[model samples]
Target chain A: MNAKIRALISEFGRLSVDVATLKNEADLYTAGLTSFASVQLMLGIEDAFDIEFPERMLNRRSFASIAAIEQAVSELLAEAGRDAEAA
Target chain B: MQTQEDYLAGLLEHGLLFSTGVDGLFGRSALFEATVDGLNALVTKHGDGFNAESVTYPPSMSRVDFEKSGYLKSFPGLAGSIHSFAGDDRAHRDLLADLEAKRDWSGRQKITDVVLTPAACYPLYPLAASRGQMPKEGLCFSLCSWCFRHEPSRDPARMQAFRQREYVRMGTAEQVVAFRASCIERGEAIVQLLELPYHLDVANDPFFGRAGKMMANNQRDQKLKFEMLIPITSDEHPTACLSFNYHQDHFGLAWGIKTADGEVAHTACVGFGMERITLALFRHHGFELANWPAGVRQALAL
Candidate 1:
């Protein structure tokens, strides 16, 4: 998930720095991630993880780092899982 | 004045704008105001035949709806949320002291009920949905608002706060798309009437990130956004004075705006950035409004 998240950031984020050497928890914006790029990354993450990001999850902090994205995806996946189990 | 710097300096010299020492925020001079009013009049004249429901929104709107509009999701960098110093007496005193000391105390501010209206038509979609499903012919509305973006730029055309006049159409895919095309045509006619050199071409919203890159490319490939650009600061990279956008089902889906068949209604909006258009006119006709061509003046009813 970390690798995928990083890849998505690199692909969509328009990083001003080297994505390969960047740490998973490093600040993406400081590394050159624009809000436009982050939203693109969010859409890509949704497609990759089969998770629809709820409205509340859309913000700068949600895509602040690879870890933040992973956590968000995990929460959404877990919610989906619970919903499926309930059904 | 061939350069961007020269053009900006010229506007300043001509007293077209009253600077507040901020790059993007400015007060318009009387002639500038008249020019904007002229652009507004032109837009109204051109859009009259469309039979749109005229609507106007306050410069501010609900922050909640702004979030739901996916504005922050897409353009958080440009989003302007109204903030105020909501502090106790001590904090307020500290804020004043910090200001007196020339320290950055803006962080002490709190977000208010208002988010600056990003687009003129944003509030309309939910309003349309609340009235229940759209009819077969769909709906059309005209709106004008003072919109805000956070981008502070030296370019006079890229104002942080600007007025937009928009005619929005919501209906089936065919209806909305047709409306966009008509807007493109109508937009072209007005540009011609103003006697300004312009080029209308496919454009994309500046989406963010790798996914946004793809989205931008897709929008262009599908011919979803078209910009009516005119030379402002530069001839090579003209500013978009007007835009024809086909939002497809994005707004309909987001705001629960549906057609009579319970299908997500496709949406399209054509917007005229009044200030940008006025600037374009100034760029073309020179700074003195009195010296402008009689035909152009007559076209704008100035």
Candidate 2:
């Protein structure tokens, strides 16, 4: 999941620096992930993960760092799995 | 203690502004026009040392260019598109009949190629880009235009159609950032010269929707925008009479504007709301231009 997120970010984040050198907790915005690029990253993440980010999570903090993105995606994926089993 | 309505009514009573039946639309009296003119001249005098290329645009802009600006994506609620009656004789008759019956005649109208100019500097980017790469010294532009936003309010300061005087700079990030910094100082000086109490603070555009919240937050975190606020309508919610923005290559990337150093040129702009500043002067000094303070009168040369 971490590798996938980093790959997606590298492809769509348009960061100023290389994503491989940055830690999971490193700030993506500081790496030059612009507002427009963040939107693109969100879309890319949604497609890659096959999960929708709730409107409530659509904020700066949700995408502030790679670690933050990983956590949010994990929680969302677990929520989706639980909902599917309930159905 | 006067209420907001009372202040607006006082302006109408004093013949400074005339009601046009619409909330935000009003006819400016000669006194109001003179004050706005004087304020514009004052802005020009302050910017006289920049050697900026001066340009004036009408109230409308090319719809194609406006679309390219992506303004709708961020401020869909505030954009205004021009529409015209593009119809044949039969359609015209139908439209007149609809109007006579007070029905929906807008169905016959068609959208035109022009959209209302939202900001004075919006049209400058593409124009600059078309002129080829920026010089090493960069480019600075002085512009004044009747800008439009769809916000209709009775605040008198938030007019739907208003004039803006702006200075825009384009070049490297360092050049653009320095220009914005200089603008902040100049903005402060202008407000001080007018003798109006003001506070300069970091600000953001009213971007739309949930995603826009992130955008606004990101803008503030980056310290890309600032405004000079004055107590025009009220003390609690002071009006933003002056704005300073650093685009940081946003326009350059979108418009293909390149610098002499072979990188995307960054951009910055400082804008003055002509009507809002004039209204602030009236509110602070007095409704009567003749009775204004000596320094204020001298600065405006009234």
TM-score leader? 2
Q: Residues A1-87, candidate 2, lDDT per residue (tens digit)?
A: 888899999999999999999999999988998788897788889898888888767777889899999888888988877442222
lDDT per residue, candidate 1, B186-260, as tens digits?
Answer: 999999989999998999887755455555665675688999999899878899999999987778878989987
lDDT of 2 by residue, B1-302 (tens): 35578889999999999999998898999989988988989999999878899987888899999999889888999999999998899999999999999999887999999999999998898899999987899999999999999998888989999999999999999988988898888888888989999998898899988657767877887888999999887888899999999988789988999999879899999999999999899999999877788998888888
Tell how far residue A85 is off in model 1, in angstroms.
31
Model 1 error, position B150 (Å): 1.2
**B147, model 2: CA deviation in Å?**
0.4
Give the top-scoring candidate (lDDT).
Answer: 2
Candidate 2 local accuracy as lDDT?
A: 0.89
User: Global lDDT of each model?
Assistant: 0.84, 0.89
